[model samples]
Target: MHNDPSNENGILHSWQQNAEAWTNTVRDGLIESRRLVTDRAIVDAVLDGQPRSVLDLGCGEGWLVRALATRGIQAVGVDAVPALIARASERGGEFQVASYEDIAAGRLPLRVDALVCNFALLGKESAERLVASLPSLLSEDGRFVVQTVHPLVACGEQAYVDGWRQEGWTGFGTAFPSPAPWYFRTLASWVGLFAETGWHLCEMREPLHPETGRPASVIFILQRH
Candidate 1:
């Protein structure tokens, strides 16, 4: 298995390659973690803030965007993968294809009440750039919400620290040829990054799987300091 996990562009390339299978898996609700817990965890997190408008930073296939729209909130989506953006657009709401570099460069010029990244922060440089630029992308009091794989649980046999980590999707499905690797950060690292980026962690929630009762994902609710 080839995981170009360390390179930022290589990570996007991997997502592009797996876009179809990923879309299928997401739409068909094949991923057990998402189906049972994390999906609702993200949606409810955003709704709890009661933001009039939301920007889903790495929204794939637009499920979260559509879900928010049903509650009468305007939702927009941006993603690097063309296929993923197309799939999201077809489903509904405003969906755009823009790389994190473009967005970080101030190309995305809409400030909303809330900015969200649902499992979208993947690469080291890319994630850093986007988070650092978030203040400009959000309204004066806009909040930022993020959902990611729980660092401790995801650390597996590796040392519990910050680095690039790769995981195969064999448990999810056999259709994926090359799974995209994600940058991993510890709990303290995450809070430090947010502070360094001019944001403070407001709330942290761990969404657990119903059956196993282990955390499926970790949510960080943040606000500009």
Candidate 2:
């Protein structure tokens, strides 16, 4: 319904304005299923010995934070939207309204055991900067987990026009409707980004769709080197 195609910032503002409704709709349908498998995989990879501190970047509505808390980890959620932050705070985790770039500028107040970034970080520049800043925020041996739309699928080259039918969800979601260029990098590019940024790649897994059982995503787990 929102169609402002200026830049990444503009797209983000649009999301902020419509995020609650959009995310709720997503959660009630396809995203909720994908998240269950993705979140569990990330938690299993990073949450060891009841980590006392964790950080969720681009935390929308604090779902990840609340999930971590239920596992006994002290989690904090950060996002750029005030409405999302407010909703996140009411769910029991500490919420901060701050951009990822702003958070990267200053040292994190605590050495977090893990940092999880879900299907957030859409902008190329911001994603690069956040990826580069992870080493400083994570404790030694800490893990950084990320799950995003597969570049091969999101880029204009390949279209999943009919795959959604097989996967049981309507494929009406736009990959990049706005002019803000998304960094749909290949697997090598993704690995190189972290390697150049001082993080050691540990594991990379692509999960299959629940319905079609076809590979639908690429998930990465990295550790500070």
The lDDT leader among the candidates is: 1
Worst 10 residues of 1 by lDDT: 1-10
CA lDDT scores, all candidates in order:
0.88, 0.68
* Cα lDDT, model 1, residue 210: 93
lDDT of 1 by residue, 3-110 (tens): 343467678889998888888999999989999999999999998899999999988898998999999999999998999999888877899998889899999889
- In model 1, the runs with Cα more than 4 Å from the true position are 1-6
TM-score winner = 1
State the local distance difference test value for candidate 2. Answer: 0.68
| Model 1's TM-score against the true structure | 0.95
Tell me the tens digit of each residue's lDDT in model 2 across 60-176. 888778878887888888888887888667757788887877877864565788888887766656777888877777877788888876666554444432111011123535232
Which pairs in model 1 have colliding backbones?
A: none
